[model samples]
Target chain A: MSEPVVATDMRKLAATQLFALIGFTVREARNKWTLLALFTLTTLFLFALATLVSIDVVEGSIASARLFGTIPLEIGNTTIPVSDAVTVIQVAIVSLLTTFGLVLALFVTGNIVPLTLQTGWVDLLASQPLGRTVLIIGRALGAVAVVAVTFAYLFGGSWSVLTWKTGFGNAGFLVAGMIILFTFLCCYSGMVLVGVLTRNSPISIIAGVGTWFMGLILYPLHTYAEWTTAFDPGWKRSLASGIAETLYWVLPKSLELTENATRATKGDALAWTPFLASMPFAIVCIALACWWFSRQDY
Target chain B: MNVIETRDLAKTFGGALGSKVEALRGVDLQVGAGEAFGLLGPNGAGKTTLVKILLGLVGASDGDATLLGHRAGTPISRLEVGYMPERRHYPGFLTAGQVLDLFGKLLGMDATLRRQRIDLVLEEVEMSSWRNQKVGGFSKGMQQRLALAQALLPDPRVLFLDEPTEGIDPLGRVSIRGILRRNLEQGKTLFVNSHMLGEVELLCDRVAILVKGKIRREGPLSSLRAPNPEYRLTIAGSDEDAARAALAAAGQEAESVPAPPGLTVWRLEVGDRSELNNVLDATRSAGLEIEEVQRVRASLEEVFVQTINEADDDKAGAGGPGGVQTSAKGATEVSVATREVDNV
Candidate 1:
């Protein structure tokens, strides 16, 4: 059969495959409610922290310093608020969001990648008329759905605060929130795609975590490579930068998306650039995920 | 025509480094319409793989097969099939009712029928009290019952049961058998994989013995019984030679041995059981005092082992000395359509 026909057939199979998955997902969520509750509480804490920092709780002192002198921090002539500037690159908030993203990824990926060492759900559904492609997509979309809800809740809370205070009534904020959520989902889907491809959960999770760690350690390597042309450090920097850039292209870059969203909402000069740049990575990651998951055995 | 037929259907797993595990090799089988045919094999004899292939769980490596006269694994074919796997797994959090309802819908049952059948199956499996209970808390036996209920929810024309009686109690097994037997009476074809030899011996009209992914023996259960040629006869006579001569005249072979001083044991070979009485009457009429007569029947287990071992011996003669051993479990059984025979 032609590839298109097969693809179409697979899509139809996927559509039919969702019913049982939805039921099973509901079951899994109920069974693991304790863990899910803890994970959600942790997420809520981050949401609370983001809201607190958004309102200038930490940087409020700096704002009060206007009694002494003019505010010194500025990004490209834009009078960035003290709280926004301070919270802009907060690694704590980034880590919190990423952890939540990981939980979402792990939860959905467990369907295909049974987190436990024992047998998984595949054995239950394998005999059914459910197609493998549909199972993977249902799982992927399920994770996306969960992540999207969290993003909406977090952003809606933030928007509520902004609406109450600064009265920023633009719906662009919601779109930006979606892009950020989808970036995580794109990355999560890619991680799950690896799980689907390997059919091993631990290996996929380790690879995902390992890549994330590597990205953190090598983030500055690119800058280091640009500044130096010397032998040892320059070469090391260049190699690190090359690896990081490749990972940057391949992995879902939620940080980049978040940065783009922030820049966009603030109407910064480079607002559209980061979001546009993120598009290629997101598209490629999702396509690769769909392709890899399509070929997965279970 | 058979409800299910396979011609040289084979499946091999693994590659060079991995052992080329032949899950099935040229398994030719046919389950006729309105017949309950048992696929009796031990565990790892490719029964599950065969079922999975029929259900489209795993693609067969080679061969062609048809179920309900349609090529296997097609949606239409699968739609007509009700399957209960050996190891039952449902979403643990779902109540038995919900589990049945979900499977019923998947099988395209209308809402009213789905609800009605779910209730009927729950009670039929004697699980009505636990219908709302989550399957996760069920014992293995209960889980098996629920699985059977789900399989029957579709009211399929063909049923594939893999170790359906594994964890069920004796009474439960009997009830499940009754349910299946009634379905068979209504003209549903059942393909069962189980290790319960006695169950199959009692239930199936015909069975196929599989070893090492190949069917070594296939026929009616009675075919496995040794042909009853040799019968025992006690005669008080000095005219044993006369009796032997008379038996011979009647186209019978009789071997005379001394059972005691006054009586002689005659090992008479006849074509059928009825001819034994005929021979005895012939001997009595010929003025030989007839004493005792009896016939022997072979146990199905003995036949099973002998048939499988002989198949192994044949294979060894052709090649090397290797015999396939599937675990004692996973052998299948079928219930008789109606208590056709009055005697057990």
Candidate 2:
């Protein structure tokens, strides 16, 4: 029973404990098959990009693309200009990364909070000298970090591969990766809030996907899908339109974010409305989750 | 100073449809520094709730709980507290050493110090050999030892163990008992929550018997296991008539236990100490030699059962709920306090 004197400061102590919690979350993330599968896919894509795929370049433009050294799909000889096709490829990559990262992250992390708060685990962590808010935030940030690293690997490696072979690259895809991460962050906050409230993983994921759906269906009808004409002209339609518009303002502007991402690929002036509106939703979710986690007992 | 204290502490858990469970109702208790305290109770007796409050796992609905002079659940209060939960679960992927290192970091230990302490605690719990092995593959006993090792990693001033011996073998129990006894010797406090009366009787300097969320009995082991008011004696000679006439002179009678031809053994119910001296005088006056005198004592198990029955509103015969009936929670029939070794 020897007592050791280290004279550690409070800030250092808090930081150390936060790091410890994050480290544990990472360890737990490694155990989850969802993360593992995502990691494996990202690695495989990187391998194929670096090894199997090749592009023939002509005057700083992608002319032909070959997959596993197959007969080149002719783009250099067709009417399609190489630059527009590369822009399409870049946006397609951004969409692929965003859609896959969002769905997989939202699905897997639905239960992450509840799982961390399970009986034995919660009992152990709660008894530690760290605050409740620190515990929750650390785990969430850890999951975010895990996703960030994985997405960065996929996005960065693909950009490098495409640039090496075809002399075509968009740094905007890297920025788009950030946007994807932010989008996932917004969804993650809601997921955590729901999981904390209900302590049910399934319900948490449903609320998360439901939020994404609402953001999609509740966007300005005419601006996104031109759906206002489909409804018969009446007070009922007005009421629906009014409610959907109100809800859309409060919800994440997901579809608009997709458009902004496309704008990013073109190196064009991007709309800030979607990014600005989506931020507050994330802030509110995180604030509410932190408050609830602090007050509630495990 | 008291390292742990609760004053009129109360906790009520909300149940379904507006129902409530009063887990702890006005429990007042204290444990001084460097003391081995045992909180013993049957299942659903609020032992878990009380411990949870002290550890800051749950909020108390009423009253106050303080740890190390800070409000329970505050960061400062748990600075020097070490807790071993009833259910042992560490990240299955982490090695034993890694688990200790992580928990050590939680205590804000530096890498140099954490490494030093982890190695030391691993040796202390005899898990040094398994330091690099994943705990997921360890047996329950090994995991139990590793759990203890983590609790000891910080060298906490107060150690709280819930069923430390649950999955350990008898020899491992002995090993843990020795480790805890040494901790007490080093002027550290040990608070144990267990249903095993024998464990408490062996390890605790003081015990509180909790029943149905109320403390029915609280005191030292010596006072709770009050000795029975009877004595057994082996006399050198066996002459029933001579012994009876001498006993009648002192107004005392003895129940003779048949013995060997050379010795006379009898059991006597003595009203007081002076009466026991008178019986000895009477036996000597009858020219009989006294070989041995023994006093039978009530076991702690018996005390626990009787206290529980008394707390059930004097249902001394009816037994309490959940069949806290006269089974002594699976204990030996009688306990001889003098024979058991005192490790603390």
Candidate 3:
């Protein structure tokens, strides 16, 4: 009983430290007017989509139309089918979730590591009894936790609204939010590295966004160059293809992860390569950041 | 037992290309349990660096240090240690209460105890009124008060405070000093690094003066002030000749300087207290009226300046850059011409 009590105490201690960091991240995000604005915008967009989905559908002999009061959603005088309309709405929601969700989360949380490394806070924190690894990991996890809640609110609200309005809700669509969060985690790990190394918020954001864009473009470039016959098979083609592939594999697979999420929602078998590959990449980035943070003087 | 100990703790930063800055070189120090120890140095004299090493905030390049019998930089070593950095900034969004809660959580205090202690510490620092206010809106003095409150949250056995009163108003500084004095009275060892010499002189039981990363002088305040036997005598009248004659008869060297109107001050170098007594007796017998007699000792600031000047002169004479080579045993030997200070 005594041993169990001690173990319980240790667990509580760990939880306390980790949660304190999470609380700090939450408070910081709340204080940023930009983050609050983005949250409000996302909430409003979800409600707007819900309103549009609530529009009545008119079915005639040759055409079906989605009527927003008196206005009909039509393409070239051909009324859109309800299924197709729902599909279009889902696609739009997914695109928004993947694009704006990722970008806003990145922009909002980019300064977490840099702010933690600020002189007074860092020195005071480092003097605490907590392990350096715990501090770094807790901070990174805090940022991820913030992004997770934001993603869940935006994506989940949109999904719930679509399901209620159209009665065609797919629970699998929720996985896309998780995937976006994972992608953000991967990208944010790099931001953490830059922030810890430089302790500069702007530099960290630039590095994180740069890595994300590189990940998005390199994989497609590699696939295109590999399959295309535009250039003859030679050293130049091989070099370009090789560089692109190496960079794709080395950097996070942001595009591939989102694509997999889209595929998963469409009742297709999801390829786990991008998801599995991204986990290690993110882990390595966090490990490197923690290693650097632990070794450096505050 | 020593609550904090460091031997030959050295830290060197940025030696990659052409220049290296040695922040600490052979700092050997010990703070006994419940003792309030002061660390005094000029700007860039490595006082903060030493505190950082002890608190495990910075790694030492050489030698070893321990707090509470654990090696420095280990998590357990800081378990019983509290540190208030010179410049403290909390997350702006957090209320003062939240800041204390965060620190208490980091210190692994349970919720009930944390709540109770937070109130106690807040009241101690006189920040109870601002407990609900955001730290961002707080003044520097208020932030300092909050910092002190957090440092006291753990009820630590050893507290390391860097410039605890810096940027504070006079009343705030007095309040902080009183809090530190109470901590010392409660048998908590305090390692204070400050540029405020008067506070150190008033509060510390022992002090170590660092000059150019070396411990130039260290001992009890009384010992550091008067390492040699000396005394000062004030004569009632302008009887310099009689005082000199009295001191000469007593086999002592005395320097005469101007005092207030119709008075002369005589600074006598004596071998011991017996010699000082003999000088006083001789002055009385010589019919030279003695107005006042007091021990001559250097103030902490004067000692600090003299130590730094002497270190600079030594550096100039050796023609070496202002670096001293140190051994792991905390023995520092000034090596001249053989090693370039720039490369260190």
Interface root mean square deviation per prediction: 8.3, 2.3, 5.1
- Stretches of candidate 3 above 4 Å error? A1-12, A53-84, A226-237, B15-18, B234-243, B259-265, B284-291, B316-344
> How accurate locally is residue B186 in candidate 1, as Cα lDDT from 0 to 100?
69
- Scored against the true structure, residue A197 in model 1 reaches a CA lDDT of 60
Residue-level lDDT of model 1, residues B87-112, one tens digit each, is: 65566778999888766645545578
Clashing pairs in 2: none
Q: Please, what are the lDDT tens digits per residue for candidate 2 over residues B174-211?
A: 99998889888988899999887777788998999887
lDDT of 2 by residue, A1-298 (tens): 4554332466677888888877777777888899899888878877876778676667765667787788666564565555566677778878876676678878876777888778777887788777787878888888788778778887788778767766667777777778778778877888888888888889989988777767766665736545755677888678767877878888788777866777787777778888898888888987898888777765
**Per-candidate local distance difference test:** 0.62, 0.78, 0.78
Q: Which ten residues in a row have the lowest lDDT in candidate 1 chain A?
A: A1-10
The fnat score for candidate 2 comes to 0.60
* TM-score of chain A for the candidates in order shown: 0.61, 0.88, 0.86
Candidate order by TM-score, highest to lowest?
3, 2, 1
TM-score comparison, 1 vs 3, better candidate: 3
The residue-by-residue lDDT of candidate 3 on B211-294, one tens digit each, is 777888899987887667566788888767877888889887788866898898877787787877888898889888888887
